[model samples]
Target: MIRYVHMYLVAILLVAGISMSFPSGRHSKAEAANDMSVHAKAAILVDAKSGKILFGQNMDESLPVASMSKLMTQYLILEKIQKGDLKWDDVYHADATDQDLSTRPGLGNVPLYQGQSYTVRDLYNAMTLVSANAASRALGRMAGKSDKHFVQMMNDKAKQLGLKHSSFVNTSGLNNQDLAPYQVKGTASDGENKMSARDLALLAYHFIHSFPNEMDIEKKELDQFPVTDSYSIPLRNKNQLLPNGKYPYKGAIGLKTGMNDAAGYGIVALAKRGQRELIAVIIDAKNKKGKRSSKARYMQAQKLLDYGFTHWDYQKISPEKFLPTNQQKIPVENGTKEKAAITSKTTVTELVPKNSHSIKAKLTLMPKFLTDQKKRELPSTYQPYGLIEVGASRVIPSNDRKLTELTLSFRKLLFFMLISVIPHF
Candidate 1:
């Protein structure tokens, strides 16, 4: 009699542990992530190939993105050029107004003559390397046939790109001083462009994947001299991550940079080593004690990229590797033999940290044989409760090198186990 009771008690404990894997929870949100100490108000890191958000903080908060908006204009230019609507050798004439705006103090520009013309190739080089406002506006005119039409196209592209929180106010993001020349109705009038860190990283990802060939120019800074029909125009790349720039990081590559009083210093930064590519964004990283530091944004972005590369890697994890059998059968409360079977939901084989370990499976199975009509035959004092909702359960797809995370609530499992079985207790 004693030995039989001990065996039954052991089965009860095992079944309780399984139910505890997941139970009804009253919590509303996930716990906070570990500290990274990133100074940017909003930041995110995304895997280039998988499009997975490896790290994020305030990723959906829309904020100004200064010169970074230029990437959109750059994308449109590349698309038009690729589709044969525009050619590299085609001429673009910067009117007298464009020249005047270029010469404006804080507005980045390369000189142009009113009547003189520049090849499409020269304008692209200037825009990517120097982030020239005049260069972007000229490309905008060509892409959309006018500045207003170009702004519309930018918004349209943002929608198509699935940028729910991104909108462009201008091509170059030079919203300083008098608004007369730069004003475009319906766009952010302050010359500020707004995008969440996630959306900005998505933009960079879209640009790189769509026009893989164009990244060559952004990999480094260069002295550019695009000659007009009348004079030579001098330009230099301003992105600090470039080889010749002040804070050049070894793996940093092509993208764009933007800054204004409102947007602070920001970069849509990309880095590659071996086969791994990472896209990181840091926006509104300002030094409150003094004036804003351009290097802060760059350093933050570099920090994120380095952390992702160093701590994160891909590995395959299978529950079967750790379990005696992938499937198990448990007994119903009154059954003489185990009839209900449960198996590991899925395996995880996607990008995980170097230290990631296999997760233990805790699953509860209810026999399909028990029906409502059968339950009525039991004593009124006996209550049965083991409700499983497959749809609501945490089931991650383990195919195609993807990782499905698993979580269990031991408390709920224990409650279900003790209540459904052990009728006398």
Candidate 2:
């Protein structure tokens, strides 16, 4: 009797430990991320491929994103180009409005004269490489056929992309009041483009995945845009993390940056080291004294990227490795065969801790497959009859790998039941 009681107590403790180790529900939110000191008003880090947010702080608060709004214009341009509705060589004639805006000091513009014609490629380079306000507005007008229609397109595309907390007021991201006569109508005259940090990360993820080649233009250290036949303005990429920039990071690639009175300083940064790619977004960054600093956004991004690369890794786990042999098959009721095999349909890849292997698989059968379900005829071979939730330690959540080829069997069912009853033990 004493031995039996001791065995029961041991089993209880083991199961309790397992339950405590892995919590219920999806991947943990920002509150659960590891502690880190970040000075930005909002920031987030996400896995590029899986779209899993690894860390976040006030990430959902909508705030002005300034010139980062050009990313939307860029996306629309690439989208139209991909559909063949637009071409890089297409010419756009500058009107008085564009020429006037291009010369506005402190607005990040290049020289342009009314009635001058420039190719779509030159304007795009200026917009992306140097955050040129007039260039972005020109691309928007060219893509949507009208600036008003283009602003609508930007908001519409934001919805389609699942940017829940984003809204656009202009193609250039400048405050609406700054646009003056060219301000997009039907919006608050003082409003600027706004997006949560999480939304920016999501936007960058889609941008890079949809048009990976855009990185080529983004990484360029220097380029020139012609304001006249013989005179051109030098365009320099401000992303300091680039290899040729002031604070060059080895793997940093092209993304986007933004700044304004309302937005302070922010950047959407991407980097690839080996097989892992990460997206980091920092917004409204300030210096130690809480004043806006041109370099603070990049430093915040560096911290995020370093933390992500140092602590996490991309891993591909085979189904066989996590699914124990005993749980591979389950019993089906009133089926042609007494037993059925439940196998993973594909390998699961996710972000997990570096140099660690502690993945656990939890199998949940459909309600109909429960052992106590009323006898009902089941197909001999049913695809996706169950799901396997795989997690690595407490970091990851159920990736929901489908389990296929389920049938019914007595002996294997008995073994499955025995293990299910004492799964951890």
Candidate 3:
């Protein structure tokens, strides 16, 4: 009896340990249900391929991005690498600015000595995996002569990419004092470093889509640098969801996280489960001691990924099916031909959710007609009129039989009138 009781106790302890190791189903469901309950200033979930916003709250409100700025840094660096302007093995020397930026407390540093040489690959790894300020500054210096010029390039690239509400004041995001050289012109406060959740997600999407190979760098559980022979820094992903392994999801790749006292906690997470990939951004999440913000972001991202996977499916709707059956031929006045045929240039297909149907399109013709302003002098050749822009909405198609007949009749009448008038001339 004593032996039996001891065995039973051991079994109970083993079961409890297993349960603790694995999250309960009830807890998972609860977490899924209350994913958005965390205190965050803004959050957004976007379809990685289409860039469609799946869910969002306060996404447009711009906020400080902290180290999330490194996304752009990584993007630009990779772009340079692809362009063959820079190589990963190329060695770069740290400047005074790089040393100053890296030495700041609270910011991650690569421990670069002034004029020390480091490879572009090492700097990139440090900037991305370790969020090293020194590496970022070194990259900026390597990319351009000065941080200001590199920042200008960043802003220019942002504008080109349609990031309307984003601005970069510094490469390192160091706070600027009134007397500081990098401070905003004619202002005491630090130069503004801001980006909206939407913009950040879009940036993430571009990074992941443009550079699939570089993404592996982010997934590294550990990477060693030859900078120091004796010392090795174990690299761990700042994102906890990647290692959780409990969630029924896959294709979750890599992204970056950011935080500063002013910016709070900002996250740009990318995940893919099956054919669908999503990028999520959480900015200005209430830290409440900083630990909870990452947890909140993970919960929110998990819920979003689950929701997307459950509710969304990709369908290849052929554009030909949505096109108008009858191509419009309009009479051209005083041209080589009496009429010109206008047809839809391309088919429009949309990837929409299931159970959704009925897409409508509207075409607006510019100049209304092919005739000139005066409508008196007929041109020698038939000139194509205005452009036709197609817009689609989820609406039932209306019957236009009577309108179609009237349009045909008007075209015939106009053609005859033009013919008759040409002879009279």
Candidate 4:
């Protein structure tokens, strides 16, 4: 009987151990840091939904982005698509300038024969999936009359998106040549493209969120171009983490991969598991001392993803609870409703940093509302105001002594009743 009891105890202990292996909304940071020390000069993992940086190393430092500049190119092209200025079926003819920009030696190319016409969809696929420089230049030329104008659009969009540390020079990240003395306006760093890991993550987040349908283009492991002729230029996606049977990480979708001698190796990888999605960026990962190879960027990204998943979780907190309740609603007289709910624009999800228990949020209201001379300002003191109709007169309590005496008497009666009831319990 004792032997049977011991066996039962052992079985129970084993089951308990297995259950303990599964996490109950908790994570460990030290374990993640130890696992992520292998590669990557700079890496950042962010919560895609909240734009919260979960983990980072050298994230703010700007670095050459190489073919990753194509991400911005993709953004601009997609922006045109969204705005109805461009379409997937639009045919773009590759001019000599486009061919020259794309066909430079040592650059990824779709090998577009000069004067070859391809649809916007084809160029977009090549630009994003194959990291084709020629495809990027073609798309740029199609979007704006000149590559220079397209580059300007990229910078303008970056500024609008609040990417403070990012800039673009060429459509394809070709090294800028010294223009003649009359044309040189800025240093190479001034014109040459660069972005911090944080900004790159933001750009990737925008792409993933804005153009979710475009993700279908990134899934093709192999694609052949020039549908008319039997001559097919086969291309493989450089982003290895996409959901392709091989190297599948649950809900792993695409992003982009980039590499050049100057830029080293960069990748912006996105993954979704259920409602939680994450974006990881790695920049300048090439070890100059030959300590590590080009694959370091990918490995670093994977490590960051693993760390983020293991150590952090998206916790949704109420904005009203954290933010001051003063400006939660804005009174608008002319709108469909008397008052418009001006809740926080973003969901208040705390990307709980590793080993951290709580997070604090600070809220700021727009100054125009507070400083407007024409509008009646809401009271600074918190007053209980039941819902009121638009253009209705605000209830201002009369300063009569009789009302005040009556309110005090009611409060005393309620207090005595509460005190009287406590003894019976």
Question: Which candidate leads in TM-score?
Answer: 2
lDDT of candidates 1 onward, in order: 0.62, 0.69, 0.56, 0.59
On residues 71-132, what C-alpha lDDT tens digit does candidate 3 reach at each position? Answer: 88888889999999889999987667666756667667667757677899988888777788
Task: Give the per-residue lDDT digits (tens) of candidate 2, residues 75-192.
Answer: 9999999999999999999999888898887788876689899999999999999998998999898999989999999999988887878999899899988898778778898988
Whichever of 2 and 3 has more lDDT, that candidate is 2
TM-scores for all candidates: the values are 0.69, 0.78, 0.66, 0.66
- lDDT, model 1, position 161: 80
Tell how far residue 291 is off in model 2, in angstroms: 2.1
Better of 3 and 4 by lDDT: 4
Give candidate 2 regions above 4 Å deviation: 1-34, 320-327, 330-338, 343-346, 367-425
Residues 213-329, model 4: lDDT tens digits: 888777677887773345677778877776563355666777878876667877888887766788888887755354545666766777778876876665554433333476444
Q: List model 1 lDDT by residue over 122-195, tens digit each.
A: 88888888887787888888888888899889989989888878877777776734345566766544556788
Report backbone clashes per prediction.
6, 6, 2, 0
RMSD to native, candidate 4: 17.6
Instruction: Please report, as a residue range, the 10-residue window in candidate 4 with the lowest summed lDDT.
Output: 4-13
Q: Which residue pairs in candidate 4 have backbone atoms (N, alpha carbon, C) closer than 3 angstroms, thus clashing?
A: none
Q: Is candidate 2 or candidate 4 better by lDDT?
A: 2
- Candidate 3 stretches greater than 4 Å from native: 1-39, 95-104, 177-189, 244-249, 286-292, 323-349, 355-425
